[model samples]
Target: SSFPAVLTCKAAVAWGPGQPLVIEEVEVSPPQPMEIRVKVVSTSLCRSDLSAWETQAIFPRIFGHEASGVVESVGPGVTEFSEGDHVLTLFTGECKTCRHCTSGKSNMCQVLGLERKGVMHSDQKTRFSIKGKPIYHYCAVSSFSEYTVVHSGCAVKVSLAVPLEKICLLSCGVAAGLGAAWNVADISEGSTVVIYGLGTVGLSVAQGAKVRGASKIIGVDINPEKSEIAKTFGITHFVNPKECSESIQQVINRITDGGADYAFECIGDTGMITTALQSCCQGWGLTVTLGVPKVNPELTAHYGILLSGRTLRGSLFGGWKPKSDLPSLVDMYTKKEIQIDEYITHNISFEDINQAFTLMKEGKCLRCVIHL
Candidate 1:
């Protein structure tokens, strides 16, 4: 299939660190071998996207991870996807030939090295440019742009029965939370589950626990306003850290009769890592940290916590093999087995993306979807 030498499109570009994204015209090169060009239909702002923007670590890049779109063109050697196929963008790529992928224990395949470098895995070069200046790709799937070229491994075809706006949440937040409970934590039926942070990811955790038939689903957040909405996602009890006279962990300990069988920290705060671990039962309690910490903050906790039979684990995309597991999750959403509409608090055009960040910072929204 022949494609244009360069496709001109609108994109929210980060020209420099900490600078607000400017919606402007940019040039996207056609996909190379093993790559596919996608026209992003809808996307959502993820907390991690904000973290990356604030850190100013990778400037001059298009930043967006959670998205749904359609294939516009296929590069040479790309037979899995064709033009017009509905798909979701994956921040984490799955090259089934890699050792990690073949092991079935991890999704962090070898292509991650190139992705970390903000370049195409086949060739260490970016596909985006503004007036000839290079614009790095963020998370391998820069859905902030109207058009993006990604490796074939980063695009997963999904059924067109669902809307791109709704299914986009499954690209990251939905999959991460649900996978954390079912795949990583392996929450058993009738178990006590505690979730920290009541944002979209945290709420999704509560839903996962509910699906697992948890006896108790406890949600903890400093904001009292989140309590009511948390309950809608299967949270049995809500704990506001600010209202508690005692420490948050102490409050959870009292509520769970020792500690919760499974605990999750959905907000990426290094301090919360210790608190989440402490909120677990001394014997056989497991805690998973799903939040992405900022600027390599060192995590610390008392040794006694680990010695008491508690486990602290970290989840990347909820340990999902994107190409293999994410499709099933999309199917679950289409079947109404999962909730997506309740999480969307605001929907705005791609140009007003800066406001989405502000809404997230003020804790006023579950998720802000950007229509491209």
Candidate 2:
């Protein structure tokens, strides 16, 4: 696959907070060394991209992180991947030199310049332009458009046999959810697991616990319809707060016999974080936080929860090391070991991006994918 030196591509632009994503024609660059220019075939909406504004990210943002595409071009020094290869982009690049990476946690790549405002790649600018004005890729891979450029480390090669449409999910929600349980918390066999917010991430956690041989998998969700697929994914107990006999915590306790051995808060809501902690039992339940709160300043609950051996922790990209985990995740998908389709409820064209965002806001779509 070859790429044009300069191409006009369709993209979603966020002018400011509380504004709708606008579709525009943005200029894309050919790949740079160790970089791969991808012709994105599919991209998915994620709350993290919307939550970036809380960090004070600049306006006119080019959002959308979970995406997949075909490698159009590779710059000098690139060898592992080539044109025509299917790949998914990771916003968090694997910087092996960083302590986080050296610690074998590539998911939390310490090299992410997320907080460095108005900064672009080493090229001094971005691969996008609007009316001759510049725009930056929201994450290293802004696949909201028809095409985008990303770092080599950010591009994870996938099984060629896997459809690019399905592989797009391995880039974000699917990876994050499974990673939280499989990598971060390490759900053990016969463990009692409780998952809050049965959206994509929460469900992924449930599947992880199931795959780990968890005997009791409890799902907690405010939406009654959320648990519709819970049992299919190995969830043994479903407690919709609306139908529960007691407080959310009590139901978890009653179901687990004392409390859950492991719990995951997939909803970034602060209130739910507290509930997630209290729902755990004595000294073994590990709670993983995979959601990004919309509120300003990273939220935290009462410090006492940390004293109960009810460990409270967070994970980025489910602690994924792109080069290693992405491929393995793709393998999992190929083998049908994990559930990715349950997350995507809708598919839209690139021009209907705002509609996708609207669906995401309404909670009508777990992942409204945009096909290029």
Most accurate candidate by TM-score: 1
TM-score of each: 0.97, 0.91
- Per-residue lDDT tens digits for candidate 1, residues 195-286, read 99999999999999999999999999988899888989999999988898899889888988999999999988888878988989998999
lDDT assessment of candidate 1: 0.89
Each prediction's whole-model lDDT (CA): 0.89, 0.78
Per-prediction CA RMSD (Å): 1.3, 2.5
Q: Taking the tens digit of each residue's C-alpha lDDT, what string does model 2 give over 91-171?
A: 777756778778854456666423234334556567778887878667667777888888787777877789888778778
For candidate 2, which ten residues in a row score worst on lDDT? Answer: 112-121
Tell me the spans in candidate 1 whose CA falls farther than 4 Å from its real position.
Answer: 112-114
In model 2, what lDDT does residue 266 have? 86
> How well does candidate 2 match the true structure in TM-score terms?
0.91
